[model samples]
Target: MEWVYIENISEYEGKEVEIKGWLYNKRSGGKLFFLLVRDGTGIIQAVVVKGEVDEKTFNLCEELTQESSLIVRGKINADRRAPGGFEIQVKEIELVHLAKDYPITPKPHGITFLLDLRHLWLRSRKQQAILRIRHEVIRALRDYYDERGFVLIDAPIFTPSACEGTTTLFETQYFGTSAYLTQSGQLYEEAGAMAFGKVYCFGPTFRAEKSKTRRHLTEFWMLEPEVAYYDLDDNMDLAEDCISYVVQRVLDRKKEELKIIERDTSKLEKVVKPFPKISYTEAVNILKKNGIEFEWGNDFGGKDETIISNQFEKPVFVHRFPAAIKAFYMKRDPLDEKLALGCDLLAPEGYGEIIGGGQREDSLEILEKRIKEHNLPREAFEWYFDLRKYGSVPHSGFGIGLERVVAWICGLSHLREAIPFPRTIYRLSP
Candidate 1:
């Protein structure tokens, strides 16, 4: 059997091609019929002429429903009016598998229903297109990091230590001790930076949250990179450059898929490097000046984040959040002692905090005090403290939520549509 993408059909014109795949759709116009076929890579219409083939082929075409798998031997022909500028002239047809009463029809399906049938619905042209874009985006991320001299490091999924807090991690029993699923590989990736200079980790992260928000997921993928000898200013620059690189790579490589998703190029075109940055105090002042009723010490709420995102033409870096609200390990500003040297990159269109990061505290004394202030187990973080006692360079890293980033790029309303098997609060089975 031979498989070919619909895009390259022009080269195979007049040549007999053996193709096998599902039937996307079938339409009849009097004596002529068209069968839309897609084999993952692309789609093309196969034309079957009346009285030009055996009775079995004609009967099979008449009875075939959508998504029925078949092997077809056909001659390709140039058709100026065809969808892909080529049509397959079938001479032989074989049913390798019969898909009966498919759940995902051409009719409209509610979001809940579509997500419920995600496994089977993935074969649809739209879903296929989104997934292809997602794949390209992931590739673009890896390429951007690899080209920038970043060493890929794998962080452990099961760890003896807890990050930030114990409330969000998924704890499991290993032998007798407790092993928690990693929420953010930031700490371990920071350790890797100390050894590898510049390191990155791309893998699944788990969060056990009861909140049922479109922005929240029970399990998701995170791409985090840490750099030694890098401060908060350096980290913000890296974030902007990395994001633009990913966007530009997607725009260049997945142009066709982007077109399929109807992503507004105008918005994406504005995603250039050197995003605007504002200090924590400045950001708070801007919000207050805009008539937002917010206190100085409170964390930015969802509405505040959306308001801030709408103001920026590109992704905006809002830095120096209150230290009291940030993680214990975040470096506190010497100038202000109350705010940490951290930032959250808010993607445009209310993408809602695609990145969260800050410079880690390098002073062993300050770190120990902060850990105790948060009521965290200090013994569990002795290994992390060792870096401070030793030669600890200024280091910073950030995590990009893979699904949220994909959703923003693809112009999808919710992040669940970005992943193949999304594990949201309401979803787990399939």
Candidate 2:
């Protein structure tokens, strides 16, 4: 009585083993029953013959329902047409628990209805595939950074001040002091960069944005990498290289999972290095050419980003944004005083901005002035200023939103499907 998983059932072909899982589906024709069983790993078909088994076993098959837990002993058989190219001839059955009529059935379910049951919906085939692909994407990210000598640094979840802005921060009272949820780990990684030369932090970040857009998430995961002495161009190079590697790894390892999610592999295959680079001025020109009434200094919205990205076959780096539109930490372009040396990597096929970063302001005087210009509290950022005050060199960093990348890689229509439990502006249960 060997316990086997459906994923590795092929190894035990022609051998009797026990499979402990839940019934996915079932069909019976007079004397024969074909039961589709799925464990967490994979799915397989188990056949039961009435004459071959006792009356009790055949009767139990008749009473089996969807998602009913059971342990069955069977001999593995290779079948080309079966799920995962395998099948089983059942010899015995043991019921663990009979699930009372599952709510999510084979019928078409509304989005709200499906989201309400997100706890159980994770067991569905599509969700499982999406999650598996997500797992591989995360694995690829870790592998890319770790092999490149980047030190892993865990940033604090709460901070005395904001990294991006105070408008979207989640304010909280911490022991009679005001603390805000971190919007990005970029600032903390800057300190780490000074200490380790190349450092990165991968963790959950919070933003209290009231946006209901398809690409916005209140709570999402971010992978921010900071490199000491890396300028804007060097930062762009790292971003393109890292992204190319992660996408290829997903394609190589998660082929079957990609097929399950119906993603067009060709699109991802085109995501190689040497991605097109354009300036903020050029991107505005593109928008104007496309009949968009976009101003030169304003930040690009979702629609504007899609229009510019659609012009290229690969992810495009739009750099040298107006200093007014970028964060206060970004360094101003030496060639153009009003432009910040920042860049955003926009995913092709209208996926929007996936990565954002730039060379940070190394001059303590300029950084202090920028902080004052942005009307930020100077005392809260005194420790941050110390990084520049002590020993600051040309440093750059960028953050990649995990959910946005997952949505783009999976070709998902909405950001909610990218995460296990989505917390949107409206929905936040299960």
Candidate 3:
């Protein structure tokens, strides 16, 4: 018998093929048995008749339990009522392994309990759809940069200093010396940008955030892209275009998956180019107009972001934030030194900032002064300062959190559902 995946079963209609997978569920009506089987690709229903196969095979189906591993030889049949517009007529059955008392049954489970069994919970249908969409998003992101001549550069997980600030850095001992887990790859990618002109790094970043918000994750993936000689305006242009392309790619390829998770495509459909842009001052005005007690120069919290994003249908870009509230590496606006030449792209429908980037400080004198002002160690940032001392020409870059984007696209309530094994302030195991 020819081994065929459930996803490709449509091509072999009326032809006998073999499928090897686990029984997702099963039901019996006296002489007939219906088995729902799932491989990693998809799920299909297999029907078994009492007289078609020998008594041993018919009796074997009775013992098959949930998540029981099995191999079945069957002929494919087209049926609109069945899932994936097809069903299988089983002729023979071979039991591989019988699972006993699977914990994840067809019942509602608490988040903590399901997360505790995360290894097995991934086998559920909803989890499968979320992960599949996540894969498409990752592929789309990589293709976007590669098509635009961006070289993929790998950044180290261990760094000598923090990229954002010291409060959130994960400190560790490095052979008697001190090191910290990288909060962002933007700093290293800047050096890569200086070397390659256009570069990006896709990898996991660590943050020691103590908060337990739905948007917070201790460990997550980031895609940081840096370009040489690109100012703030050029950076925002790239950011909007890149996001639109990625969202459209998902809408094109993962329609069924999105439907499984019940994502409102209408919100995603409006993610085209020329996203709404407003300065920090304008955004603050919006918050105050909406009656949100947000003080200017303070970073926007979750509720504040939701109020601002609600003003537009598509993802909005809020630019030129207060220089004091931004990272020390961000370049100050020439027209207004109090403002930094940075922008944050906030996802609509209450999904907060998914992308943050800005022009880097190009002057050695100014950078040294900013570092001193931020109280970052001067010795650790010597290499970073070298980029400015040599050939820095107003380069800009941004990092997109992969989990947050996946969470937004999938319409998931929590960031934990976007990642396979989420590392939060409280979770670290299976």
Best by lDDT: 3
Model 2, CA-based lDDT:
0.92
The lDDT, on a scale of 0 to 1, for candidate 1 is: 0.87
1-430 in candidate 2: lDDT tens per residue?
A: 9999887887999999999999888886689999989888888899999888888989999889999999988899988867788899999989899988899886789999999999988888899999898899899999999999999997999988888764588899999999999999888999999999999999998888898989988889999999999999999999999999999999999988899989999989999999999999999999999999988888899899999999998999999999998899999999999999999999999999999999999999999998899999898888899999898899999999999999999999999989999988888798
Residue 349 C-alpha lDDT in model 1: 90
Where model 3 places Cα greater than 4 Å from the true spot, the runs are none
For TM-score, candidate 1 versus 2, the one ahead is 2
Worst 10 residues of 3 by lDDT: 161-170
Overall lDDT per candidate, in order of appearance = 0.87, 0.92, 0.93
Compare candidates 1 and 3 on TM-score and give the better one.
Answer: 3
Ranking by TM-score: 3, 2, 1
TM-score of each: 0.97, 0.98, 0.99
Q: Candidate 1 has what TM-score?
A: 0.97
- The lowest-lDDT stretch of 10 consecutive residues in candidate 1 is 1-10
Candidate 3: residue 165 lDDT (0-100): 67
Q: Report the Cα lDDT for residue 179, model 3.
A: 95
Angstrom error of the Cα, residue 358, model 2: value is 0.7
The TM-score of candidate 3 is 0.99
